[model samples]
Target: MPSVLKTQPWNVHRLPAAEGKRFLVTGGNAGIGYFVAEQLAGTGATVVLGSRDAAKAEAAIASIRSRVPGAKVQHLRLDLADLASLKTSVDALGPDRLDAVVYNAGVALDHPPRRETKDGHELMFATNHLGHFALTGWLAPLLVATPGSRIITTGSFAAKSERLDFDDLQNTHDYRPKRTYGRSKLAQMLFSFELDRRLRAAGSTTLSVVVHPGGALDSLTPSRPQVRVRTTGERLRGLPLGLLVQGKEAGAWPAVRAVLDPDVRGGHLWGPRVFGLRGRPGLAPIWDHLADTTTAARLWAASCDLTGVAPTFTPV
Candidate 1:
Protein backbone atom coordinates (compact mmCIF):
# COMPACT_ATOMS: atom_id res chain seq x y z
CA MET A 1 0.00 0.00 0.00
CA PRO A 2 1.24 3.45 -0.83
CA SER A 3 1.92 5.86 2.01
CA VAL A 4 -0.86 8.38 2.68
CA LEU A 5 -1.00 11.32 0.33
CA LYS A 6 0.33 14.69 1.27
CA THR A 7 -2.71 16.44 2.75
CA GLN A 8 -4.30 17.87 5.90
CA PRO A 9 -2.70 15.57 8.51
CA TRP A 10 0.72 13.97 8.16
CA ASN A 11 0.62 10.33 9.09
CA VAL A 12 3.68 8.88 10.80
CA HIS A 13 2.72 5.26 10.22
CA ARG A 14 2.21 5.75 6.48
CA LEU A 15 5.45 7.16 5.13
CA PRO A 16 6.16 7.33 1.42
CA ALA A 17 8.47 4.77 -0.16
CA ALA A 18 12.13 5.68 -0.14
CA GLU A 19 13.60 2.65 -1.78
CA GLY A 20 17.33 2.71 -2.53
CA LYS A 21 17.82 5.80 -0.39
CA ARG A 22 20.04 5.80 2.69
CA PHE A 23 19.47 7.75 5.91
CA LEU A 24 21.50 8.11 9.08
CA VAL A 25 19.89 8.78 12.45
CA THR A 26 22.34 9.71 15.16
CA GLY A 27 21.72 8.17 18.62
CA GLY A 28 19.35 5.77 16.94
CA ASN A 29 19.91 3.16 19.62
CA ALA A 30 17.02 4.50 21.62
CA GLY A 31 14.55 7.32 22.29
CA ILE A 32 13.20 9.47 19.46
CA GLY A 33 16.12 8.53 17.22
CA TYR A 34 15.27 4.83 17.42
CA PHE A 35 11.70 5.46 16.30
CA VAL A 36 12.92 7.68 13.47
CA ALA A 37 15.22 4.94 12.22
CA GLU A 38 12.54 2.28 12.52
CA GLN A 39 9.98 4.36 10.62
CA LEU A 40 12.44 5.18 7.83
CA ALA A 41 13.39 1.49 7.59
CA GLY A 42 9.76 0.73 6.85
CA THR A 43 10.05 2.96 3.77
CA GLY A 44 12.50 0.47 2.22
CA ALA A 45 15.44 2.74 2.82
CA THR A 46 18.74 1.73 4.35
CA VAL A 47 18.71 3.09 7.91
CA VAL A 48 22.05 3.41 9.62
CA LEU A 49 22.02 3.96 13.36
CA GLY A 50 24.82 6.27 14.40
CA SER A 51 25.75 5.20 17.93
CA ARG A 52 28.82 4.92 20.14
CA ASP A 53 27.87 1.59 21.67
CA ALA A 54 28.06 -1.52 19.49
CA ALA A 55 25.82 -3.54 21.79
CA LYS A 56 23.12 -0.88 21.89
CA ALA A 57 23.27 -0.39 18.14
CA GLU A 58 22.86 -4.11 17.57
CA ALA A 59 19.87 -4.23 19.86
CA ALA A 60 18.26 -1.30 18.05
CA ILE A 61 18.84 -2.89 14.66
CA ALA A 62 17.34 -6.16 15.86
CA SER A 63 14.33 -4.38 17.25
CA ILE A 64 13.83 -2.46 13.99
CA ARG A 65 14.09 -5.58 11.87
CA SER A 66 11.60 -7.40 14.08
CA ARG A 67 9.14 -4.55 13.70
CA VAL A 68 9.81 -3.76 10.07
CA PRO A 69 10.48 -7.23 8.69
CA GLY A 70 13.20 -7.27 6.06
CA ALA A 71 14.16 -3.77 7.15
CA LYS A 72 17.46 -2.57 5.74
CA VAL A 73 19.29 -1.31 8.79
CA GLN A 74 22.84 -1.35 10.18
CA HIS A 75 25.06 0.34 12.76
CA LEU A 76 27.74 2.97 12.37
CA ARG A 77 30.05 3.57 15.31
CA LEU A 78 29.71 7.28 15.95
CA ASP A 79 30.89 9.04 19.07
CA LEU A 80 29.72 12.60 18.48
CA ALA A 81 31.53 13.82 21.60
CA ASP A 82 34.86 13.08 19.89
CA LEU A 83 35.22 15.68 17.15
CA ALA A 84 38.45 14.19 15.80
CA SER A 85 36.74 10.87 15.00
CA LEU A 86 33.90 12.34 12.85
CA LYS A 87 35.79 12.48 9.58
CA THR A 88 36.79 8.84 9.98
CA SER A 89 33.17 7.99 10.72
CA VAL A 90 32.06 9.67 7.49
CA ASP A 91 34.72 7.88 5.46
CA ALA A 92 33.49 4.55 6.86
CA LEU A 93 29.96 5.22 5.56
CA GLY A 94 31.10 3.40 2.36
CA PRO A 95 30.45 4.20 -1.33
CA ASP A 96 26.67 4.21 -1.14
CA ARG A 97 25.29 7.70 -1.66
CA LEU A 98 23.58 9.25 1.33
CA ASP A 99 20.09 10.62 0.82
CA ALA A 100 19.61 12.23 4.22
CA VAL A 101 21.13 12.51 7.67
CA VAL A 102 19.10 13.24 10.82
CA TYR A 103 21.12 14.94 13.53
CA ASN A 104 19.17 13.64 16.52
CA ALA A 105 21.80 12.60 18.99
CA GLY A 106 22.17 14.88 22.00
CA VAL A 107 23.44 14.91 25.58
CA ALA A 108 21.36 16.46 28.35
CA LEU A 109 23.04 17.31 31.64
CA ASP A 110 20.41 18.08 34.29
CA HIS A 111 22.95 18.90 37.00
CA PRO A 112 26.65 19.41 36.91
CA PRO A 113 29.84 21.20 37.82
CA ARG A 114 30.32 21.20 34.03
CA ARG A 115 32.26 18.61 32.03
CA GLU A 116 34.53 18.68 29.04
CA THR A 117 35.49 16.14 26.41
CA LYS A 118 38.99 14.86 25.77
CA ASP A 119 39.29 17.59 23.15
CA GLY A 120 38.83 20.12 25.98
CA HIS A 121 35.40 21.35 24.85
CA GLU A 122 32.26 21.37 26.97
CA LEU A 123 30.49 17.98 26.74
CA MET A 124 26.91 19.01 25.89
CA PHE A 125 28.02 21.70 23.45
CA ALA A 126 30.51 19.36 21.82
CA THR A 127 28.08 16.48 21.46
CA ASN A 128 25.00 18.52 20.63
CA HIS A 129 26.34 21.14 18.24
CA LEU A 130 30.04 21.15 17.35
CA GLY A 131 30.21 17.44 16.60
CA HIS A 132 27.32 17.66 14.14
CA PHE A 133 28.83 20.80 12.67
CA ALA A 134 32.04 18.89 11.97
CA LEU A 135 30.20 15.81 10.77
CA THR A 136 28.08 17.88 8.36
CA GLY A 137 31.21 19.43 6.91
CA TRP A 138 32.68 15.98 6.37
CA LEU A 139 29.47 14.74 4.75
CA ALA A 140 28.91 17.87 2.66
CA PRO A 141 30.49 16.40 -0.43
CA LEU A 142 28.31 13.29 -0.38
CA LEU A 143 25.20 15.33 0.29
CA VAL A 144 26.00 17.70 -2.54
CA ALA A 145 26.42 14.77 -4.89
CA THR A 146 23.14 13.14 -3.95
CA PRO A 147 20.15 14.75 -5.64
CA GLY A 148 17.36 16.01 -3.33
CA SER A 149 19.36 15.09 -0.25
CA ARG A 150 18.51 16.59 3.12
CA ILE A 151 20.14 17.45 6.42
CA ILE A 152 17.58 17.31 9.22
CA THR A 153 18.56 18.70 12.59
CA THR A 154 16.70 17.94 15.80
CA GLY A 155 16.51 21.01 18.02
CA SER A 156 14.49 21.21 21.25
CA PHE A 157 11.69 23.26 22.76
CA ALA A 158 14.01 23.78 25.70
CA ALA A 159 16.18 25.87 23.38
CA LYS A 160 13.48 28.37 22.45
CA SER A 161 14.17 30.69 25.38
CA GLU A 162 17.95 30.39 25.30
CA ARG A 163 20.44 32.59 23.49
CA LEU A 164 24.15 32.16 22.91
CA ASP A 165 26.80 34.23 24.59
CA PHE A 166 29.25 34.47 21.70
CA ASP A 167 32.07 35.52 24.03
CA ASP A 168 31.39 32.54 26.23
CA LEU A 169 30.22 29.91 23.74
CA GLN A 170 31.42 27.15 25.99
CA ASN A 171 30.02 28.65 29.16
CA THR A 172 33.59 28.60 30.46
CA HIS A 173 33.35 31.32 33.12
CA ASP A 174 29.92 30.34 34.44
CA TYR A 175 28.11 27.11 33.73
CA ARG A 176 24.76 25.74 34.72
CA PRO A 177 24.03 22.30 33.28
CA LYS A 178 20.48 22.76 31.96
CA ARG A 179 20.98 26.27 30.64
CA THR A 180 24.17 25.29 28.88
CA TYR A 181 22.42 22.32 27.33
CA GLY A 182 19.67 24.65 26.06
CA ARG A 183 22.28 27.00 24.64
CA SER A 184 23.88 24.11 22.80
CA LYS A 185 20.58 23.20 21.17
CA LEU A 186 19.99 26.84 20.27
CA ALA A 187 23.34 26.63 18.50
CA GLN A 188 22.08 23.64 16.54
CA MET A 189 18.97 25.53 15.43
CA LEU A 190 20.99 28.54 14.46
CA PHE A 191 23.35 26.39 12.47
CA SER A 192 20.49 24.75 10.63
CA PHE A 193 19.15 28.08 9.37
CA GLU A 194 22.58 29.40 8.46
CA LEU A 195 23.40 26.21 6.59
CA ASP A 196 20.20 26.58 4.59
CA ARG A 197 21.15 30.12 3.60
CA ARG A 198 24.61 28.96 2.54
CA LEU A 199 23.22 26.04 0.57
CA ARG A 200 20.86 28.37 -1.24
CA ALA A 201 23.62 30.83 -2.07
CA ALA A 202 25.67 27.97 -3.43
CA GLY A 203 22.64 26.72 -5.42
CA SER A 204 22.97 23.27 -3.91
CA THR A 205 19.99 20.91 -4.05
CA THR A 206 20.58 19.58 -0.53
CA LEU A 207 18.02 21.02 1.88
CA SER A 208 18.62 21.75 5.57
CA VAL A 209 15.63 21.63 7.92
CA VAL A 210 15.37 21.89 11.69
CA VAL A 211 12.87 20.20 14.00
CA HIS A 212 12.06 19.83 17.69
CA PRO A 213 10.80 16.69 19.45
CA GLY A 214 8.67 18.86 21.71
CA GLY A 215 8.28 17.44 25.20
CA ALA A 216 8.80 13.74 24.60
CA LEU A 217 8.98 11.47 27.61
CA ASP A 218 10.17 7.89 27.99
CA SER A 219 7.25 7.01 30.20
CA LEU A 220 4.89 7.91 27.35
CA THR A 221 6.79 5.93 24.72
CA PRO A 222 5.95 2.44 23.55
CA SER A 223 8.20 -0.48 24.51
CA ARG A 224 10.67 -1.95 22.05
CA PRO A 225 11.96 -4.67 24.39
CA GLN A 226 15.63 -4.86 23.39
CA VAL A 227 15.72 -1.14 22.82
CA ARG A 228 13.64 -0.07 25.84
CA VAL A 229 11.21 -1.49 28.38
CA ARG A 230 8.59 0.93 29.69
CA THR A 231 7.21 -0.21 33.02
CA THR A 232 3.46 -0.49 33.51
CA GLY A 233 3.62 2.07 36.27
CA GLU A 234 5.49 4.42 33.98
CA ARG A 235 2.79 4.10 31.32
CA LEU A 236 0.08 4.79 33.84
CA ARG A 237 1.87 7.87 35.05
CA GLY A 238 2.45 8.98 31.48
CA LEU A 239 -1.19 8.60 30.51
CA PRO A 240 -2.16 11.78 32.31
CA LEU A 241 0.67 13.77 30.73
CA GLY A 242 -0.26 12.72 27.18
CA LEU A 243 -2.38 15.85 26.79
CA LEU A 244 0.72 17.97 27.17
CA VAL A 245 3.62 15.66 26.32
CA GLN A 246 4.07 12.82 23.86
CA GLY A 247 5.98 9.58 23.38
CA LYS A 248 9.43 9.45 21.80
CA GLU A 249 7.82 7.82 18.77
CA ALA A 250 5.57 10.81 18.27
CA GLY A 251 8.51 13.10 18.90
CA ALA A 252 10.30 11.52 15.94
CA TRP A 253 7.58 12.74 13.58
CA PRO A 254 8.90 16.15 12.58
CA ALA A 255 12.40 14.92 11.70
CA VAL A 256 10.99 12.01 9.74
CA ARG A 257 8.64 14.36 7.89
CA ALA A 258 11.39 16.81 7.15
CA VAL A 259 13.38 13.98 5.61
CA LEU A 260 10.63 12.57 3.41
CA ASP A 261 8.11 15.33 2.83
CA PRO A 262 8.36 16.62 -0.73
CA ASP A 263 6.82 19.89 0.31
CA VAL A 264 9.28 20.51 3.13
CA ARG A 265 11.99 23.03 2.26
CA GLY A 266 15.14 24.41 3.78
CA GLY A 267 15.02 27.07 6.52
CA HIS A 268 11.84 25.55 7.85
CA LEU A 269 11.14 24.61 11.47
CA TRP A 270 8.79 21.69 12.15
CA GLY A 271 7.35 20.58 15.47
CA PRO A 272 4.25 19.29 17.19
CA ARG A 273 0.97 21.03 16.36
CA VAL A 274 -0.63 21.60 19.75
CA PHE A 275 1.16 24.41 21.57
CA GLY A 276 4.23 23.08 19.78
CA LEU A 277 4.20 20.40 22.42
CA ARG A 278 2.19 17.23 21.78
CA GLY A 279 0.45 16.17 18.58
CA ARG A 280 1.22 15.40 14.95
CA PRO A 281 4.12 17.30 13.44
CA GLY A 282 3.52 20.53 11.54
CA LEU A 283 5.19 23.79 10.61
CA ALA A 284 6.36 25.55 13.77
CA PRO A 285 7.32 29.20 13.97
CA ILE A 286 11.04 29.83 14.12
CA TRP A 287 12.22 31.42 17.35
CA ASP A 288 13.58 34.97 16.98
CA HIS A 289 17.07 34.07 18.10
CA LEU A 290 17.28 31.50 15.36
CA ALA A 291 16.99 34.30 12.77
CA ASP A 292 19.88 36.35 14.07
CA THR A 293 22.22 35.85 11.14
CA THR A 294 25.06 37.67 12.86
CA THR A 295 25.13 35.27 15.73
CA ALA A 296 24.79 32.30 13.37
CA ALA A 297 27.68 33.50 11.20
CA ARG A 298 29.87 33.96 14.23
CA LEU A 299 28.89 30.53 15.54
CA TRP A 300 29.67 28.99 12.15
CA ALA A 301 33.09 30.59 12.04
CA ALA A 302 33.85 29.44 15.58
CA SER A 303 32.64 25.95 14.71
CA CYS A 304 34.88 25.81 11.65
CA ASP A 305 37.84 26.87 13.77
CA LEU A 306 37.04 24.48 16.57
CA THR A 307 36.48 21.45 14.35
CA GLY A 308 38.85 22.36 11.50
CA VAL A 309 36.21 21.38 8.96
CA ALA A 310 35.26 24.17 6.59
CA PRO A 311 32.31 23.25 4.41
CA THR A 312 32.21 24.71 0.92
CA PHE A 313 28.90 23.95 -0.74
CA THR A 314 28.71 24.30 -4.51
CA PRO A 315 26.53 22.78 -7.15
CA VAL A 316 27.83 19.26 -7.80
Candidate 2:
Protein backbone atom coordinates (compact mmCIF):
# COMPACT_ATOMS: atom_id res chain seq x y z
CA MET A 1 0.00 0.00 0.00
CA PRO A 2 1.12 3.52 -0.69
CA SER A 3 2.15 5.16 2.57
CA VAL A 4 -0.24 7.84 3.83
CA LEU A 5 1.37 10.91 5.40
CA LYS A 6 -0.24 13.31 7.83
CA THR A 7 0.42 16.96 7.13
CA GLN A 8 -0.96 20.39 7.97
CA PRO A 9 -4.13 21.34 6.11
CA TRP A 10 -3.45 24.06 3.50
CA ASN A 11 -5.56 27.18 3.27
CA VAL A 12 -5.76 29.91 0.61
CA HIS A 13 -4.61 32.68 2.97
CA ARG A 14 -1.09 31.28 3.00
CA LEU A 15 -0.90 30.47 -0.70
CA PRO A 16 1.71 32.43 -2.62
CA ALA A 17 0.92 34.09 -5.95
CA ALA A 18 2.43 32.12 -8.83
CA GLU A 19 4.46 35.09 -10.05
CA GLY A 20 6.54 33.13 -12.51
CA LYS A 21 4.29 30.22 -13.25
CA ARG A 22 1.91 29.60 -16.15
CA PHE A 23 -1.07 27.32 -15.61
CA LEU A 24 -3.85 25.83 -17.71
CA VAL A 25 -7.06 24.85 -15.89
CA THR A 26 -9.64 22.84 -17.78
CA GLY A 27 -13.31 23.67 -17.08
CA GLY A 28 -12.31 26.93 -15.44
CA ASN A 29 -15.55 28.75 -16.25
CA ALA A 30 -17.31 27.63 -13.09
CA GLY A 31 -17.30 25.49 -9.96
CA ILE A 32 -13.99 24.21 -8.56
CA GLY A 33 -11.96 25.05 -11.63
CA TYR A 34 -12.91 28.72 -11.36
CA PHE A 35 -11.79 28.97 -7.76
CA VAL A 36 -8.53 27.23 -8.56
CA ALA A 37 -7.81 29.66 -11.39
CA GLU A 38 -8.73 32.57 -9.15
CA GLN A 39 -6.41 31.41 -6.38
CA LEU A 40 -3.53 30.76 -8.77
CA ALA A 41 -4.03 34.11 -10.46
CA GLY A 42 -4.07 35.85 -7.07
CA THR A 43 -0.62 34.37 -6.58
CA GLY A 44 0.50 36.17 -9.78
CA ALA A 45 0.39 33.11 -12.00
CA THR A 46 -0.62 33.65 -15.63
CA VAL A 47 -3.68 31.42 -15.88
CA VAL A 48 -5.28 30.23 -19.09
CA LEU A 49 -8.85 29.05 -18.74
CA GLY A 50 -9.54 26.07 -20.96
CA SER A 51 -13.21 25.67 -21.77
CA ARG A 52 -15.30 24.16 -24.47
CA ASP A 53 -17.31 27.34 -24.89
CA ALA A 54 -15.37 30.34 -26.09
CA ALA A 55 -17.88 32.83 -24.71
CA LYS A 56 -18.00 31.16 -21.32
CA ALA A 57 -14.22 31.09 -21.23
CA GLU A 58 -14.09 34.80 -21.99
CA ALA A 59 -16.68 35.52 -19.32
CA ALA A 60 -14.73 33.54 -16.76
CA ILE A 61 -11.65 35.55 -17.61
CA ALA A 62 -13.61 38.76 -17.12
CA SER A 63 -14.88 37.59 -13.77
CA ILE A 64 -11.35 36.88 -12.59
CA ARG A 65 -10.07 40.17 -14.01
CA SER A 66 -12.67 42.02 -11.96
CA ARG A 67 -11.44 40.51 -8.68
CA VAL A 68 -7.72 40.48 -9.41
CA PRO A 69 -7.35 43.82 -11.21
CA GLY A 70 -4.09 42.89 -12.86
CA ALA A 71 -4.77 39.20 -13.11
CA LYS A 72 -3.19 37.73 -16.22
CA VAL A 73 -5.92 35.48 -17.51
CA GLN A 74 -6.55 34.21 -21.03
CA HIS A 75 -8.89 31.72 -22.67
CA LEU A 76 -8.06 28.77 -24.87
CA ARG A 77 -10.82 26.91 -26.65
CA LEU A 78 -10.89 23.23 -25.76
CA ASP A 79 -13.65 20.64 -26.06
CA LEU A 80 -12.87 17.35 -24.36
CA ALA A 81 -15.47 15.54 -26.43
CA ASP A 82 -13.81 16.46 -29.70
CA LEU A 83 -10.37 15.07 -30.52
CA ALA A 84 -9.89 17.58 -33.32
CA SER A 85 -10.71 20.38 -30.94
CA LEU A 86 -8.20 19.00 -28.46
CA LYS A 87 -5.48 18.99 -31.10
CA THR A 88 -6.30 22.50 -32.18
CA SER A 89 -6.25 23.85 -28.67
CA VAL A 90 -2.90 22.24 -28.00
CA ASP A 91 -1.38 23.53 -31.22
CA ALA A 92 -2.77 26.98 -30.48
CA LEU A 93 -1.03 27.11 -27.10
CA GLY A 94 1.95 28.62 -28.90
CA PRO A 95 5.52 27.93 -27.75
CA ASP A 96 5.19 28.90 -24.10
CA ARG A 97 6.22 26.35 -21.49
CA LEU A 98 3.47 25.38 -19.07
CA ASP A 99 4.18 25.11 -15.35
CA ALA A 100 1.09 23.04 -14.64
CA VAL A 101 -2.03 21.59 -16.24
CA VAL A 102 -4.98 20.81 -13.95
CA TYR A 103 -7.44 18.30 -15.34
CA ASN A 104 -10.50 19.50 -13.45
CA ALA A 105 -13.16 19.10 -16.12
CA GLY A 106 -15.50 16.10 -15.88
CA VAL A 107 -19.06 14.90 -16.43
CA ALA A 108 -21.48 12.43 -14.86
CA LEU A 109 -24.29 10.63 -16.64
CA ASP A 110 -27.60 11.43 -15.01
CA HIS A 111 -29.74 9.04 -17.05
CA PRO A 112 -29.63 5.26 -17.09
CA PRO A 113 -28.84 4.52 -20.73
CA ARG A 114 -25.31 5.32 -21.90
CA ARG A 115 -24.60 8.24 -24.20
CA GLU A 116 -21.72 8.73 -26.60
CA THR A 117 -19.54 11.76 -27.00
CA LYS A 118 -18.51 13.38 -30.29
CA ASP A 119 -15.47 11.13 -30.30
CA GLY A 120 -17.72 8.06 -30.24
CA HIS A 121 -16.64 7.11 -26.71
CA GLU A 122 -18.94 6.74 -23.72
CA LEU A 123 -19.89 10.23 -22.55
CA MET A 124 -18.70 9.93 -18.98
CA PHE A 125 -15.60 7.99 -19.90
CA ALA A 126 -14.65 10.30 -22.74
CA THR A 127 -15.19 13.55 -20.91
CA ASN A 128 -13.82 12.41 -17.58
CA HIS A 129 -10.82 10.36 -18.64
CA LEU A 130 -9.96 9.92 -22.31
CA GLY A 131 -10.49 13.57 -23.20
CA HIS A 132 -8.04 14.63 -20.53
CA PHE A 133 -5.79 11.78 -21.54
CA ALA A 134 -5.55 13.05 -25.10
CA LEU A 135 -5.18 16.65 -23.99
CA THR A 136 -2.32 15.82 -21.64
CA GLY A 137 -0.63 13.70 -24.28
CA TRP A 138 -0.87 16.49 -26.83
CA LEU A 139 0.45 19.01 -24.34
CA ALA A 140 3.36 16.86 -23.14
CA PRO A 141 5.84 18.73 -25.29
CA LEU A 142 4.97 22.04 -23.71
CA LEU A 143 5.05 20.46 -20.25
CA VAL A 144 8.51 19.03 -20.94
CA ALA A 145 9.81 22.44 -21.87
CA THR A 146 9.70 23.46 -18.25
CA PRO A 147 11.54 21.74 -15.44
CA GLY A 148 9.29 20.31 -12.70
CA SER A 149 6.14 20.81 -14.72
CA ARG A 150 3.22 18.97 -13.14
CA ILE A 151 0.11 17.28 -14.50
CA ILE A 152 -2.60 17.31 -11.83
CA THR A 153 -5.69 15.20 -12.50
CA THR A 154 -8.95 15.01 -10.54
CA GLY A 155 -10.16 11.58 -9.43
CA SER A 156 -13.03 10.73 -7.09
CA PHE A 157 -13.77 8.53 -4.07
CA ALA A 158 -16.33 6.78 -6.27
CA ALA A 159 -13.37 5.28 -8.06
CA LYS A 160 -13.09 2.88 -5.15
CA SER A 161 -16.47 1.39 -6.06
CA GLU A 162 -15.73 0.66 -9.69
CA ARG A 163 -12.67 -0.98 -11.17
CA LEU A 164 -11.61 -0.55 -14.78
CA ASP A 165 -13.38 -2.92 -17.15
CA PHE A 166 -10.70 -3.35 -19.76
CA ASP A 167 -12.99 -5.52 -21.88
CA ASP A 168 -15.81 -2.98 -21.81
CA LEU A 169 -14.01 0.35 -21.84
CA GLN A 170 -16.79 2.02 -23.80
CA ASN A 171 -19.55 0.11 -22.03
CA THR A 172 -20.54 -1.68 -25.21
CA HIS A 173 -21.23 -4.89 -23.30
CA ASP A 174 -22.92 -3.40 -20.23
CA TYR A 175 -23.75 0.27 -20.04
CA ARG A 176 -24.24 1.51 -16.54
CA PRO A 177 -23.65 5.26 -16.40
CA LYS A 178 -22.67 5.32 -12.74
CA ARG A 179 -20.36 2.39 -13.14
CA THR A 180 -18.90 3.93 -16.28
CA TYR A 181 -18.19 7.20 -14.52
CA GLY A 182 -16.49 5.39 -11.67
CA ARG A 183 -14.45 3.31 -14.06
CA SER A 184 -13.30 6.44 -15.90
CA LYS A 185 -12.15 7.98 -12.64
CA LEU A 186 -10.37 4.78 -11.74
CA ALA A 187 -8.57 4.97 -15.04
CA GLN A 188 -7.58 8.55 -14.23
CA MET A 189 -6.13 7.55 -10.85
CA LEU A 190 -4.25 4.66 -12.36
CA PHE A 191 -3.00 6.86 -15.19
CA SER A 192 -1.60 9.41 -12.77
CA PHE A 193 0.41 6.79 -10.90
CA GLU A 194 1.57 5.06 -14.06
CA LEU A 195 2.59 8.33 -15.68
CA ASP A 196 4.75 9.16 -12.70
CA ARG A 197 6.45 5.80 -12.87
CA ARG A 198 6.99 6.10 -16.59
CA LEU A 199 8.32 9.64 -16.30
CA ARG A 200 10.83 8.65 -13.65
CA ALA A 201 11.89 5.56 -15.55
CA ALA A 202 12.41 7.71 -18.64
CA GLY A 203 14.50 10.15 -16.57
CA SER A 204 11.95 12.94 -16.95
CA THR A 205 11.48 15.50 -14.21
CA THR A 206 7.78 16.12 -14.82
CA LEU A 207 5.41 14.96 -12.06
CA SER A 208 1.95 13.39 -12.35
CA VAL A 209 -0.29 13.61 -9.30
CA VAL A 210 -3.91 12.61 -8.70
CA VAL A 211 -6.43 14.14 -6.30
CA HIS A 212 -10.11 13.65 -5.38
CA PRO A 213 -12.32 16.48 -4.24
CA GLY A 214 -13.90 13.90 -1.94
CA GLY A 215 -17.66 14.10 -2.36
CA ALA A 216 -18.12 17.78 -2.99
CA LEU A 217 -21.43 18.88 -4.48
CA ASP A 218 -20.33 20.48 -7.71
CA SER A 219 -21.81 20.73 -11.20
CA LEU A 220 -20.42 17.30 -11.95
CA THR A 221 -22.81 15.59 -9.58
CA PRO A 222 -25.93 14.21 -11.23
CA SER A 223 -29.35 15.46 -10.20
CA ARG A 224 -31.23 12.38 -11.38
CA PRO A 225 -33.80 10.79 -9.07
CA GLN A 226 -31.48 8.00 -7.96
CA VAL A 227 -28.58 10.38 -7.41
CA ARG A 228 -30.70 12.84 -5.45
CA VAL A 229 -32.14 10.09 -3.29
CA ARG A 230 -28.74 8.69 -2.45
CA THR A 231 -27.17 12.10 -1.86
CA THR A 232 -30.17 13.38 0.08
CA GLY A 233 -30.21 10.32 2.29
CA GLU A 234 -26.51 10.81 3.04
CA ARG A 235 -27.13 14.44 3.96
CA LEU A 236 -30.27 13.72 5.99
CA ARG A 237 -28.47 11.02 7.95
CA GLY A 238 -25.34 13.19 8.24
CA LEU A 239 -23.21 10.48 6.80
CA PRO A 240 -19.55 11.37 6.69
CA LEU A 241 -18.67 8.63 4.28
CA GLY A 242 -18.44 10.86 1.22
CA LEU A 243 -14.99 12.24 0.50
CA LEU A 244 -14.72 16.02 0.83
CA VAL A 245 -18.41 16.67 0.21
CA GLN A 246 -18.34 20.41 0.66
CA GLY A 247 -18.23 23.68 -1.24
CA LYS A 248 -16.44 24.13 -4.55
CA GLU A 249 -13.62 26.17 -3.05
CA ALA A 250 -12.79 23.52 -0.50
CA GLY A 251 -12.95 20.86 -3.19
CA ALA A 252 -10.42 22.67 -5.38
CA TRP A 253 -7.82 22.69 -2.60
CA PRO A 254 -6.38 19.30 -3.43
CA ALA A 255 -5.65 20.36 -7.01
CA VAL A 256 -4.27 23.65 -5.75
CA ARG A 257 -1.99 21.84 -3.30
CA ALA A 258 -0.78 19.50 -6.01
CA VAL A 259 -0.08 22.47 -8.27
CA LEU A 260 1.71 24.82 -5.85
CA ASP A 261 3.18 22.81 -2.98
CA PRO A 262 6.94 22.78 -3.59
CA ASP A 263 7.41 19.82 -1.29
CA VAL A 264 4.72 17.63 -2.84
CA ARG A 265 6.23 14.46 -4.24
CA GLY A 266 5.21 13.09 -7.62
CA GLY A 267 2.49 10.40 -7.60
CA HIS A 268 0.99 11.57 -4.28
CA LEU A 269 -2.81 11.82 -3.90
CA TRP A 270 -4.23 14.76 -1.92
CA GLY A 271 -7.75 15.48 -0.67
CA PRO A 272 -9.83 16.52 2.35
CA ARG A 273 -8.57 15.25 5.72
CA VAL A 274 -11.97 14.85 7.41
CA PHE A 275 -13.53 11.49 6.66
CA GLY A 276 -12.41 12.02 3.07
CA LEU A 277 -15.06 14.74 2.99
CA ARG A 278 -14.90 18.54 3.24
CA GLY A 279 -11.99 19.99 5.19
CA ARG A 280 -8.72 21.83 4.77
CA PRO A 281 -6.25 20.24 2.35
CA GLY A 282 -4.13 17.27 3.48
CA LEU A 283 -2.30 14.26 2.06
CA ALA A 284 -5.01 11.77 1.05
CA PRO A 285 -4.26 8.05 0.97
CA ILE A 286 -4.47 5.81 -2.08
CA TRP A 287 -5.57 2.18 -1.98
CA ASP A 288 -2.64 -0.18 -2.57
CA HIS A 289 -4.36 -2.06 -5.34
CA LEU A 290 -4.89 1.17 -7.28
CA ALA A 291 -1.14 1.23 -7.82
CA ASP A 292 -0.84 -2.31 -9.15
CA THR A 293 1.88 -2.33 -11.80
CA THR A 294 0.06 -4.76 -14.00
CA THR A 295 -3.16 -2.76 -14.04
CA ALA A 296 -1.38 0.51 -14.58
CA ALA A 297 0.57 -0.86 -17.51
CA ARG A 298 -2.54 -2.26 -19.12
CA LEU A 299 -4.50 0.98 -18.72
CA TRP A 300 -1.58 2.97 -20.08
CA ALA A 301 -1.46 0.79 -23.15
CA ALA A 302 -5.21 0.96 -23.63
CA SER A 303 -5.30 4.76 -23.25
CA CYS A 304 -2.57 5.15 -25.83
CA ASP A 305 -4.28 2.82 -28.25
CA LEU A 306 -7.65 4.44 -27.78
CA THR A 307 -6.46 8.02 -28.03
CA GLY A 308 -3.91 7.41 -30.78
CA VAL A 309 -1.31 9.27 -28.80
CA ALA A 310 1.81 7.27 -27.99
CA PRO A 311 3.40 7.73 -24.59
CA THR A 312 6.14 10.32 -24.88
CA PHE A 313 8.43 8.47 -22.49
CA THR A 314 10.30 5.44 -23.76
CA PRO A 315 9.75 2.89 -21.03
CA VAL A 316 12.98 1.53 -19.62
Top TM-score model: 1
Model 1 ranges off by over 4 Å: 1-9
lDDT scores for all predictions? 0.92, 0.80
Which tens-of-lDDT digit does each residue in 176-257 have in candidate 2?
7788788888988898898898889888888999888876764333222311223655455444433336766678888998
Position 274, candidate 2: lDDT: 83
Clashing pairs in 2: 17-43, 18-43, 214-243, 215-243, 215-245, 243-276, 244-276, 244-277, 244-278
Residue 297 CA error for candidate 1 (Å)? 0.5
Q: In candidate 1, what residue range of length 10 has the lowest lDDT sum?
A: 1-10
TM-score of candidate 2 to 2 decimals: 0.88
Instruction: Give the C-alpha miss distance for residue 80 in model 2, angstroms.
Output: 1.2
Off by over 4 Å in 2: 1-9, 218-244, 314-316
Model 1 has how many clashing residue pairs? 0
Per-residue lDDT of candidate 1, residues 137-224 (tens digit)? 9899899889999999999877878989988999998789989999999999999999999999999999999999889999999999
For model 2 the local lDDT of residue 166 reads 77
